[model samples]
Target: MLLCDTPNLVSSSEVIAGVSDHDALLAELRVDSRRPTPLPAMLPNWRRAPWPKLNDRLAEEMHAVLQINNLNDAWTAWKTTLVGCVSECVPSRKSRPKRRLLPWLDKKLKKMIKIKDELFAKWQVEKTLESRNLFETARRASQGAVRSRLSLPAPRAFPRRKAKRVENHGERRRQLAIHVLDAKSATGPDDVPAVLLKRCAKTLCPSLAHIFNLSLRACDLPTDWKCAAVTPIPKDGEKSDLRNNRPISVTSLVGKLLEKHVRNQLAGFLDTNKALPDNQHGFRERRSCTTMLLRTLDSWTAAIDKNSGGHVHAIFLDWANAFDKVPHQRLLSKLQHHGIDGAALEWLKNFLVGRSQFVRFGGARSEPCVVSSGVVQGSVLGPLLFNVYVSDLPAVVKTNLVQYADDCTIFREVTSQDDVDELQEDLALIDIWCVNNGMQLNAKKCVAMDLSRARQPRLPQYMIGGAVLEYVSTQRLLGVHIARDLRWNHHVDVQRKKAAQTLGFAARNLRGCTQRVKRMAYLTLVKP
Candidate 1:
């Protein structure tokens, strides 16, 4: 009964009577080759567009000031005009005689997948431990072969702000476009290429500014702009499971350009009001993993250098799905506390609420689902918003804390068992904070590392959410590994081996490529 009409799909059908005590039909399909995936007819060939004429047309149309009445209508009109200009200048991608196949799934990946299927069949039939293990190994290899390419509390009475208009947003818009709008970046769901915006920034800034000002002044975001196009990238796990993959969303880049402006304003407000603690090292200007590690290590070394046989007990807290679990109402309340109120706060509320996202892999797409919680995954403002959401986390932790966004490392200098008890109390308070804020702490992955030179080092147990944290003598903090003996040999060796393997892969594939390509390969693959 199994039939396949497609040329690429070669099918084999069989009937077996012994399988289920009845005649069972078995069908197998082999996709050895396929034609190129046809892109949506709407996506224009923007790279070959008449950019100068496009710019001139956009300028001529948008030179006049828009008389705004209804916000959505205005947005719709602008989008229509923008589309019209593009249609006139840019050629459709369908104009091509034949499109080439995408090279993401090659012969090697196909071969590995075939091996994995064979092993799976063997394991299913034999049902032995060794066979199962071999199957799992093959599954992991197939997964790897395909993967070679890719908080916070509400505040009480806060200041209500008078709305202030952005001054000279035209110039600011032009500057932001020049810096943040990358020509090479992916196009959003709107099918507008970033190259179009970046190249025509000079001519389009006025109209863009007008649109942006309308959004800010009216405290409204367009419906299309809020819809995110999500792309799921494989993570370090079995790729067959959806939960193991990471979702990176591509929201409207035009919306994101406005987000950048809002981000700057919000950051300035936080800095002026001192809302965030210095312990936060993620997403802030001039702070990174290395800086956070240096400070954490400095605190440990200082604690250890003291003559009282003082030891530092550190617990690295992991927030489970930290970005995805951010509550929108809680975030807005915190933003209000941080002096972002009135128009800015309203704009953010509109931005975060009623958003939808659809997952896209190649030419396929999932249905768009409404997002009730969490900021957009691959958004320009997600990190900053999360930081603001958990701004008060450091307050609850009584001991020394180093935070890089959600990855919090809490430690204390312990001279006696009483100090350990005090640190334990701090951990209890953090657990309570997570409960009150709808955040889950991954205590199973949490670890307590005691930094001491003493032969008889006291490593105490820590508990969060009734789960005991494991004790570890060696842990990787940031990218650098920390050992109980404070040696760098293991870390250096691991990095060396990783670099060598990556270099070999690059070299094997890049034999006939140019020197420039080889250099880029090294920089992107091996050097990093």
Candidate 2:
């Protein structure tokens, strides 16, 4: 008999109830939070030693501490000494005051802010109408004062009338125009301004086309071009912690333009050559998470239709820093395997090698450090390179693998216990592949789910690196809620909540705004 009919799988409601009880138990064991959480301790701005000075000190210390010629050991020593020097120069301040966001905030505004704070404190102590009214008045005055100081023009008082939302041909054209303008204005992190990009693209495309047709090309890059500026952005958790941040590169406008052309050529060539598997959907033509989901559902349905009474078990695999961890040499080998060589390959190698980056946040910029690995983030070619890097993963693993860029789901239909063993074997094989490819599986975030309509489903426990994977009743695959029973009620409920939140934001911000603006917000934000 299939595991789904084995009377072991718990119902959704039962799972929810159990989760609630578990949460209650955790809350009881944890400390009560009667007071507000304190802000993170941060170093003073003045104490932040200049990057050049830190680098000099770091070099001296690394030379003194490290005797080994081993590259890995040398790197470890360098990082350790660098951290020490940084800490010595810029020590943490536990009681440091919060940094003000507004630079132009004057003494008058500060006084008003203090008054408002006092009023709030009083209201917190004693809830009275007079205190509340005073607080509201002070808040409005302080805000108005700030706006007035900034020389912001006051809105013209027009007679209030509800604008009709009735759509016509003219309105449709106007809305389309608004969308076009908005998209044009919304440049990404590494993108040049729309005007500059248009001018460059127009002038460069024809020459670029000619270059693509050339049989031989030199590996020389422009010497005058500045290296990309690297900025550290918080991945998650406390921003004050250096470990929480990852480097993002901002390259030159011309570099981005050239990369855009390369990306287009590479994507076309790969698609035409059928180098990417049909299961690989991300960054590929006419493929998406939606299509992947539909195909997965169809496959499972077909299995059921075969009268095999099999259960579909899926493992959503996550990689730790997938793009950043790709081995450059291996990537080059893969590109060559896919018939990319000569000028194209050499240009890509130039793009990848000897790249330096500096950490920039706010006004403070660090000294440049050489980046040994990873494709440049925020570049047009980054995703394409990553796709090509992991394109052959399907051949490495035995099971049905569905990939959306780095997001992968391995699924197999199981009837007997022997089939469950096969699924585990496939996971082991994938682990070996990841090991060889210089990537690590984030076993904690990985989850296993059994998809079945049967009342009870029993599936084998999967492990990666000796860590047993968590079994989930519902798993979110590419922003879509997927459950064992394939019911969409949970997904719909989540989307409805998100839509309501967006609608509330529009109601607050676009209340007195133009009807067209409101419509644009509705269409782009709420509708999606």
Q: What local distance difference test score does each model get?
A: 0.80, 0.68
Best by lDDT: 1
lDDT of 1 by residue, 358-471 (tens): 988767788999999997767788889998888898898779988898888899988888998999999999999888888999877888888877677787777888998888
* lDDT score, candidate 2, position 229: 68
Q: What lDDT tens digits, residue by residue, belong to model 2 across residues 486-525?
A: 7788889999999999999878865544566567668777
User: Over all chains combined, what TM-score does candidate 2 have?
Assistant: 0.61
Task: Indicate the worst ten consecutive residues by lDDT in candidate 2.
Answer: 23-32
TM-scores for all predictions: 0.77, 0.61
Clashes of 2: 1
lDDT of 1: 0.80
- Deviation from native of the Cα of residue 237 in model 2, angstroms: 4.4
